[model samples]
Target: MKKKIVFYVRNLEFHAISKNLQTIVNSLDKKNFEITIIVGEKKYSDFILDNFSKEIKIKFILNDFLTSFRSKKYKKNFKNKIFLDFIKLFLNLKSIYEIKKNNFDTFIDYQGMYLSDFLKYTSIKNKITVLHENRYIGITNDKKRKKIKKKFKNYNKIIFLAKEQTNDFKLLYPDLKDRFFNIYNCFDINKIKELSMEKFTFDEIKWVDNKNYGLMLSRLENGKDFQTVLNALGELKKIDKLNFNFYFLGEGSLKSFLEKEIKNLNLEDNVFLLGNKTNPYKWIKKSNFVIMTSHSEGLNNVIIESLILEKIVIANKFKYGAEEILQNKYGFLFNNENYLELVNILKKITKENKKSTDYFPEIKKSYSRFSSINILEEFNKIL
Candidate 1:
């Protein structure tokens, strides 16, 4: 008998959770597993629909909270507050009914948010929730943390993205430690390799063929601490001549501020903000190495992508995933607070990393370990 599994998510944005879900559903064993994805948000990018398993089932429900809040008519009406509340009440009841109708053997919360409230109103058991980010951020409310801590008993298994994330959570809630499991975020290693070979349409970045250029594929957000890169570039100029030009590939609210800082540091020519790229693999392939200076992460995908492409990855211990992914074998990690250490390391590697041919085999092995097949197999063990 095929086990019915449903992956539940709040929204289908072009983020890690949606991508991981699509990869899992697209690659699941169709013979052994019957799959469905129920999205709470009404609309998602066609990119999502294109990537999801066409052979399986997918539904996008009108998330009333988001709909009601965004409705212009509701905002114009003086009674909008009460009207929105009524809409929310109707939608919640309807959504709960839809959820109860599905007789799934397992329900996976692809995004770690509050959905247990719906579970309380239904008889469905075997709820599994996966945490995909550094839980330390956006979880500072002591009351909310206590609520989540109390609710941990309701889940069958809580999956963490890294060993360190799991260990930290275990330390906090020793009682629920037995319910926790660790899983690496799956990377479509082969897909990335193929994409990296595609030719680039963007203008060529000016650089010497011999000097190593570092790629930073991340969102320009405060949590990421991108200022460290700028500060490091400024500091490198004072003492030693820096050889690398860094390219940032993602966008965020901090873009303008970062541009200003880069100008102030006189690094405008050295650092280029390429904004967001739907396909960054070609850029990844051309770069000499990759670097991440985030304060925390669940599992940095860029680091894995860099390794798969046979480029050296420089990162900090951050909070989680760094040490586990790098393991002192494939990449380098420096003090998160010490930008100087990052510069020194980058400088040293620029001098030493003349030939990457020797690192390709071992680096490729690291990527194969996190491929989609392994991810589905791990899920099958629990399902």
Candidate 2:
């Protein structure tokens, strides 16, 4: 009999988590396992439904009662806190009932919250929860810590996305180290290649014809540090007498702020915020260089995508995925300093041998979909 593997996701929108889940389900062997997804209702349900394969089973739970109300109207600063508590309660009860009804071989909590409490309450022995990040890092107060500690003890196995992330958890709770597993996020080489084939047109932006350009594909968030890229560009423009452009893809809360900054820097002619594009691979392929300025990340999908597309990447020396991926001469890394450092690095890269595409095949093999499946198999071993 095949083992049943169910992924529980809170939102059904076409976000990164949903996309990653789809890739995992598609890669799993149908003969060995039965894959299913349970998600909340969303306007873009079809975004996920269209990607489903015939071999995989998908279940949608249209539960929006808890999430239906906007937290902004509550007027309390802790509105989100109140709303999430309600969600946690509902999910805990729902998961407990479901586990009792189906008795799945293994219940995997992808979101990794109090859903694990369901297994504890129902006495479902086979259960695993993957923690995406350290919850206590941003949370204060001993009460929240105690609550998380209670939830942490319920999981049969706890999977961490990175080694550093695992170590952080171990440092916090030494006893849970035995249950921690570090599984780096995997990339789908074939799927990335498939996405690359899709054509994207930016004739609306009137991009310069046959000009060297760099691309940054990320949400316009403060943590991403896009201002660094703008400053770098301003320095490059001031010193180097070359005509180059930057194509920024994606949208977020900082869009207006970034727009004002660009105008202030007089970069309206060189930098183009192309907004959010569904397919960013086309821009990646066309660009001469890919840049990432994130203050932190958890195995960024864009870096892997850029590597697969054979575009040279320049990223900040952050504690996260940038240095991890670019260590083997696949790309370049610079310190997080003023624009002078970035300008100097850009000058150096322009002068040095730019034949770094030789490492593409190795990178593709190491982070392939097969690697993810192997990790999942190891995760199942604990159960």
Candidate 3:
């Protein structure tokens, strides 16, 4: 009999977790396993339905939570934190019940992003939680760490995206080290390369029409450190006599702040915020280069995608994954904190090897080592 498996994620965003989970789903032998994906939000239901429903079933936890008036009204009321939590629990209980009826043998939380979503999966005997960000494990207090460790002990396995992430978590709760497994995020290299082939007219992105550019597909969030990246661009503009517009293509809370900062730095003409493109790979393929300025990350999917498309990349030296991915080849990594160093690296790339496309051979070799085929044995070893 095939084992019934379910993958759960609270966020409905089409992002790394979604892509990585899809990779895992695609790798599973249908003769041996049945798959289902349960997401908490329904707004992006079609995203999974359209791409993945042929092989796996799709379900939602909080059905219509995005369109529900009570949910929306309560979200705006800051003082109703306790009430909001109570209402969410009421809604999630039904979702938990629905999932329980399916009797899945394995339940995998793609990213332990929402604690409530994690709590809802207790009906499944085999619980596997994947923690994507090592740098975001913010529990420093001994008491809280102990409590969290106790919660983690309930799961059969806790997977980290990288070894550095595993080490970071072990520092918080050493006893859980035995239960931890390191599984680097994997992708379909050929699929991404193929998707990058889809043609988009210049009108698809108007700003790039007349500009030499660097592309950054970052969420406008604090962790992305957009300020430091903009500052470095400002510095480069001041020194180097070259014209390059930096295109930022993702959405988050910091969009207005970043826009104002760009204006303040006199970079309104150079830094363009393009707000979450469905096909960022198209821009990645066309840009002069791609960049990552994350203060920290689990493993950036875009970096790998950029490499698969053979784009010259300038990335920040993040705590865990950048070194492992870049590994002094295929791309350049500068100090994310040091503005001057970032500026200098940009200067060197522009002056020395700006329009080069020779990285595909090395990038393909590295990407192959991290592809789903290579990751399959490691993932199954734990089971």
Candidate 4:
């Protein structure tokens, strides 16, 4: 019998978690698993939906009334505590009804956020939640940590993208250590190469046309440490070694801040913010290499995708998943805190103008372990 599985996420935004969920959904064997995706938010990018198989079903938990009630328009109109309480009651009841209506064999929380409040009340035997980031990174509060630990007890299993993440989480909740499982995110290698070859005109190609370029494929928000990257560029310019153009392919809250910083650092000519691209692989393929300076990560998908595309990756030695993914051998690793180190590495890479073919043999040997077939076999064991 096909296992009826439902994956729940807060929203299907153009982010790493959503992309990882998409990859898993597409890679699963349709003959053995019947898939359904439930989203908490009503508003989401259909870009992920466009790529999903037709057989996969999608449902929104929030109805039009609840969606409008949660919107800016309704908040401004309805400020009564009694009305707010009524909305909360309706939502909880609705969620409970939605969950109980389906007798799913497995319930997977794709994102660790507690969007599905009624999940704890569900009696599903195979309850799972996937934590995408380093849980203990910025969280310093003891109360919050205890609250999260209590929440994890509701799940039968917890999926972590890196072994380090699994180990750290185990330390936090020693009694629940047996519930944790480390499963590396898988990639569709051939599909990534095929997408890179897609015929799409990038108008900003002129910026890096004949020059060496490095791509940063991430959201422009906190914890990314983009300032360090810009500072490194500033240092490289001072030494006259800043020959390559740096492009940011994703959008976020920090766009204006980064733009101002770029101007302040006099890196207008060396740095370009290309905003979010639906197909980032094309940009990754065209660039000389990829860069990641995140303070915390759970097996960065961009770094993996860069390697799959045969592009070199330069990242910080993050405590969580950086060394595990890069292995400290495949790509360049610099101190995320030290801009001077980043500057030196930037100088070295630009001066070398290294080709992907040089690392092709090692890259292929290392990345093959993350293939879809291998991941599916492991994933099936859990299901």
Candidate 5:
């Protein structure tokens, strides 16, 4: 009999976790596993759901009636915190009821935040939670750390995207060492290849055709360290090495700040903030380099995609993110503290004008581990 697996997410926003969950669910072997997704809330752009295969089941815990209570207008009109708490309580209970009713063989909490609570109540033999971000962030308080450790006690396995992330977690919580597992995120390599060939047109394509443009495929947010990127660009300008354009492909609350900073740094001509796109692989295919300057990440999806497309990548040397993926073998890593290092790397790339094709042979071998078959084997081991 096929094993029944269900994944829980608070919502399906346009981010790596949701996208990875969609890819993994779709890529799983249908003959061996039956997949279902349960979302806690509904949103206007749940586009991630549309990518799933027809065989995958999908549901929303908050039906229309429960969803109405979540509106800003409703909250403003009622102004009752108790009512909101009651709603959350009801939803949690309802979530437990619905999940237990499904009789799934395994429950995978994709976000690893709110859904982990269900592990205490559910008796599912296989309980797993996947942490998508650097868990060290925003949990400095001892009480909060203790609470997280306690909450994670009932989980069968706690999945981290990088081996270093797993190692760090074990160091932080030694008692939970046995529960930690590292499953590198999955990707649909074939699908990305096909999508990269799609004739998606952007107006600036011609302007950047002959220019050495770099692509940053991430949300324009503070944590992504756009400030550092802008600073590096400013340094490059001072040294007369700013010969290329850099484009950001995702949208976030930092768009206005980034625009202001770009003008402040006099990089208006060298920077473009293209809003999020349905398909970013085409952009990656067109760029000379892919850059990542995040303060921290579990495992950056763009870094992997850039390597898969064989584009030169320059990323911050985070202990668990870029360094783990690139290892300075497939891509370059610079000191996160020194913007000048990034500037120097950018200058080197512009002077060399080399594509990642220089290392395409090795990149292919390095990236083969992310194939669906290999990832499925990892999942089977955990399950």
Candidate 6:
């Protein structure tokens, strides 16, 4: 008989968790494992359900009352608060109850937030809670810290995406270090190769025929430091006498601010905001190079995707993934907001004819979907 493994998450969308879950589900052996996903009701869930193979089962859960109540406190807008609360109280509660009813062999909580509370309430014994990081324990107030710590204590296995993230967790609860597992987020290497080979249809903006263009695909959040990319672009123009078009993909709160900065810097002609593209990989393939200027990141999916496309990457030396992925050869890294240095590096890479193929084999060998399944299998063994 196949072992039933259920993954609980907020949504089955195109987010980081969903992407990884999709990869893992596709990679797993159907004969040995029966996989089911429990997620909140969202339009993206329909996309996943439609695309997934018949062997894997997909389930929807509604948002809970506590989640809605919390949304009211956090969300400033009154209408949004009301709407979010309704989804939580009705939809989320129903979903949680349904999951509890279908008692699986293994229950994995992908979202480390309120999902833990639901798991704690449920009588599910073989439960594994995966956390990217213990953000609440270290960053929040004493009350919140206690609550998070209590949640951390309840899980059968606590999985971290990176070793550094695991180290951060160990600092908080030294005793639980033994229970902590480091599972590097991985991609389907075969799928990546397949995607790279497939020709993507570019629709809206026309790609510049001759000039090189840089690509940055990320949420326009404050922590992303897109301003740094804009500043670097200005400096590159002045110092290297280089002219390149830049495509900023994805939407965020900083849209207006970034637009204002682009206008102020007189890069209105050069910089183009393509909004959110359903197929960002198409843009990645068309670009001369890719840039990531985040203040911090957990293993970035975009970086890996760019590498698979054989596009050279330039990134700020963030704590988690950029430096880890680049390893000095695949791309260039800037220490700080030194635009002159970035400009010089851009000049060097632009002139080069050959692509860096050094990291490709290693990344394929180590960071594949099969590797992630092996990591999860090891976790299953421990459980």
In the order shown, what is each candidate's alpha-carbon RMSD? 3.6, 3.6, 2.8, 2.6, 2.5, 3.8
| Deviation (Å) of 23 in candidate 1 | 1.4
Maximum-lDDT candidate: 5
- In order, the Cα lDDT scores of the candidates are 0.76, 0.69, 0.75, 0.81, 0.81, 0.70
Candidate 4 residue lDDT tens string, 1-383: 99999888867878988878888999898999999988766756678778988889988877666666665433334455567667766665665566668889998877884534567667788888888887554577999887787788778888899888888778778999999999989888888899998755667567556777888988988978898888888988988857688898889889999999999999998798988888888888888888898888878888888888878888898867778887866787887678899877777767877675564447766678788888988888888
Ranking by lDDT: 5, 4, 1, 3, 6, 2
TM-score of each: 0.87, 0.84, 0.90, 0.92, 0.92, 0.85
Off by over 4 Å in 2: 41-47, 63-92, 134-145, 202-209, 350-355, 358-383
- Sliding window of 10 residues with minimal summed lDDT for model 6: 358-367
Q: Can you write out model 2's per-residue Cα lDDT over 1-383, one digit (the tens) per residue?
A: 98877777776565566666676677777888887766643334465668777887665453445545522246555866777667667655765676567667777787656475566566556677766544455566789877877887887688777677678778877877887787766657666777877654667335635677778888787678787888888877777753677888888889899889889888888888888666677777777788888776656777778887777788887656676667656677788756567777677666563644543435544345335656566655664
Worst 10 residues of 4 by lDDT: 71-80
Candidate 5 per-residue lDDT, tens place, 1-383, comes to 99999888877778888888888888788899988888887652546767779999888888766676665444443556778777788777777787898899998888875766666677798888888887554577999998888878868799998988888889889988999999999888888888887775667567456777888888877678787888989988987947788998999889999899899999898898989878888888888898888888888899998887888988988756788788778888888868888888888788987767574447766577776668878988876
- Candidate 3 local distance difference test against the native: 0.75
Quality of model 4 by C-alpha lDDT:
0.81
lDDT agreement of model 1 with the native: 0.76
Give the Å error, residue 335, model 4.
1.3
lDDT of 6 by residue, 1-383 (tens): 88888887776655667777777777677888888887765436354556677788876554345444543446568887787667666655676686778777777887764466666557777778776533443465777767777877777788777677778778877877887777776566556666554454555545645657888998787767787788877877766655678989988788999899999887888888878765566677777888888777667778878877777788888767677777776677897666667777677777674464542345333334334545556555744
Worst 10 residues of 2 by lDDT: 358-367
CA lDDT, candidate 1, residue 192: 84
As a TM-score, model 4 comes out at 0.92
Order of models, best TM-score first: 5, 4, 3, 1, 6, 2
